[model samples]
Target chain A: MTGLADRRPEEDSVAMPRVSFTENLKRHVDCPPQDAAGGTVRAVLENVFADNPRLGTYVLDDQRRLRKHVTVFVNREMIADREGLSDAVGEGDEVFVFQALSGG
Target chain B: MTDAFHVATRKGLFRYERRNGGWQAGAPAFLGEPVSAVLTDPRDGAIYAALRLGHFGQKLHRSRDGGTSWEELEAPKFGAEPPPPSPANAENFEADMAARKAAQTVDTIWIMTAGGADQPGVLWAGTLPGALFKSKDHGESWSLVESLWNVPERAKWFGGGADLPGIHSVHVDPRDSAKLTVGVSCGGVWKSDDGGETWRQAGQGLRAAFLPPEMQYDPVSQDPHRLAHSGDTVWCQHHNGVFLSRDGGESFTEIEEAGPSVFGFAVATHPDDPESAWLVPGVKDETRVPVDGKFVVTRTRDGGKSFEALSNGLPDGPAWDLVYRHALDIDGTGERLVMGSTTGNCWLTEDGGDSWICVSTYLPPIAAVAWA
Candidate 1:
């Protein structure tokens, strides 16, 4: 599986996905507005991690897969692929990463 | 002005700096996040904070400039197990079950202890689900200590606070860096004399009242609320009572008369005096509070033969503050001690428990306190 480090920008510019993290995640990491360019959900996330390396480990596991407690939504729908994170992404898509912070 | 103490509370991390003649509370770090453990690396002045976000899992952050700023780092993560082979039949059921058990995430970094003087950048972290992690690059990276996790006795361990057992104490012998001891909740004292290459149960004489009479003496079933290392002795304020071991945790001797109630969470051992240790006693496990609703701290100067209740400047009535396992600590001078409680109250004593002063009374439920 290709990680964020190996992705190359396409010749035809793809609309950068706007990535945002939950407030709980922002507490531990520096999460600001950033545009991620990719064709798939995995690529956009890899782009997000490329800008902020540490956040990757928080949202994904060592296997480069989404963490169990982490949820990622593409536009209005939750991504169906967790293992591959290969859900397709379109230009202008907004990716939302939610970390369920509940209970004591 | 030296910053001598730090408190890890449910809300955040607070450093107590000694200014003029008293300790002053500094601005909080990781504000509004629960910090379970905090340790200052005396060798490099780096501060490591273990923050547990209920939704995002546990994380570790380090500050090289006292508590000025922090950089989040990779937390200890259990190795992932590969998916089981196809064909869900009885032949592969056992292997499937074992693989699932190997991939548990670290729910919390329950305890953090710096390595000895000669072992700079070497640190040990204990976590929930009862696992150990060691980092050689300060708090930058960590690798699980699989030898201790694979111990056969671990199968029987269960959590005291959550559904999974957790490790709350990790003590490295100052005299010998390779010799280490760990205290686990629902599990007993464990020792690794060969730098964690191997481990063995060290609760030979520790007792648990909740166990069956015949199982009371079992080694792996002991619940040690807190463990403090002083000189060559290891002092444990267990769920049942106080215990002491002089021979590196090979065996423990219960101190029957070591408290006003014998049930509490926090315990601190003087850095230079092995005989002097402190404990804050609550009513009992079920009714965890001050005895008769009066707060007091018990001290022992004669190796736990007897205990003296210290309440000079503390609340005297209807005060039910319960101190957690890591909320009490003694400074390097062995004279100044600081303790915080679940009720958001903090106290300090510069005269070795002879008297006390309120440090703060409205912070947050303190989870850990360390005198750096």
Candidate 2:
């Protein structure tokens, strides 16, 4: 029987999505590029936040809604559900987070 | 008189120290950021500064060793649960949802005060969108005071100068930590006798001239810009005029003899004398400049029976300085007072309000000043 360490590299990459944050956000909180496993935008972000709770505050509000000044994109397209964050995310997709231009 | 004071401004937090017999400003902390509120905890000398960042949301920092360094702390925040529907708007589900959404987020930390001297490490903060929070272990963590937030009368509170109503004043009775009072813009005043376990509307005589004649005396509709206390006597710089309350905040009597004009924001009450208080007067409403472009500080020594305008060392007419609600502060001795204005002007009065000296003509627009 094959163990976990014997899994192929391609299988690992296809099971998770890549996530990145705006460079400017580093000044306030640390958010490094990494891979998170989730099927939807909310699930992916929640996975990341589960590791770094402080970063979540800078991106979302008390209601768990994306902050008015923060924007998220999945696979180069902006996520339409800011409040519920119901947008779908595919494995190996690139998720980018940005601070809205108006906030600056 | 105190040897140091802190000034919260649009750009940063400034610390002014009495050096060589004169006050001198040191380098600022949080420079280039909007310092909304600064609390110099007299009990332990811990300084907490609240910052309102355009993109990062409200942040709080505490400096244990003066303002030399700071460590960011968790700011007050509401929970995920939406507020209970108000009876006044229960029929309109859409409007109720909008109100709950607006109340869930903290906009700015308007004011913070240390708990009673006995309750060390205890801190109380009031925030915009009108919520109260308490911290029992210094500034390490905070929890919302749900009892006050859920009061039925809060539904009637509306905005005065901001889009959402804010609790700008929190007065914890020096004699008893459990007894507390808070002043809200457009929400009159509320008092909690059991350390915030419960609350009730308290400002009975506050009047709102801007409202309809029938609703002018409605306690929930009154707008109290600020509240200062001298022992048990409370002084309110209301939207319409200055009011004095002898029974804490149960009742108030409008002071009709304020110098220049009765409309202004800041008020400093003498720590030792209940009858003595100071006010900065300006034209009311649309024109918020000094009355006729003349800036003045009004002092009432006889329980608001009369007022004396003191402007010996201040700038001449054509000066358009309007002091915010927390910009003027009186030291513990009640003799030294510092006042800052919206136009970046700061004045220091060493002998009460008899004379003043311009400290800085260009600092940032001042938000609050407190003796350290």
- The lDDT leader among the candidates is 2
DockQ of structure 2: 0.37
Q: Top DockQ: which candidate number? A: 2
Please write out the lDDT profile of model 1 over residues B294-361, one tens digit for every residue: 89999999898878999999996789899899888887888888889999999988899999999999
- Per-residue lDDT of B44-149 in model 2, one digit per residue for the tens? 9999999987776888999999899999898899887653354455798667656655547888999999999999999999999899999999989999999999
Q: What is the TM-score of chain A alone in each candidate?
A: 0.80, 0.86
Worst 10 residues of 1 chain A by lDDT: A1-10
TM-score of candidate 1 relative to the true fold: 0.87
- Docking quality class, candidate 1: acceptable
Off by over 4 Å in 1: A1-19, A31-47, A61-69, A79-94, A101-104, B1-3, B83-102
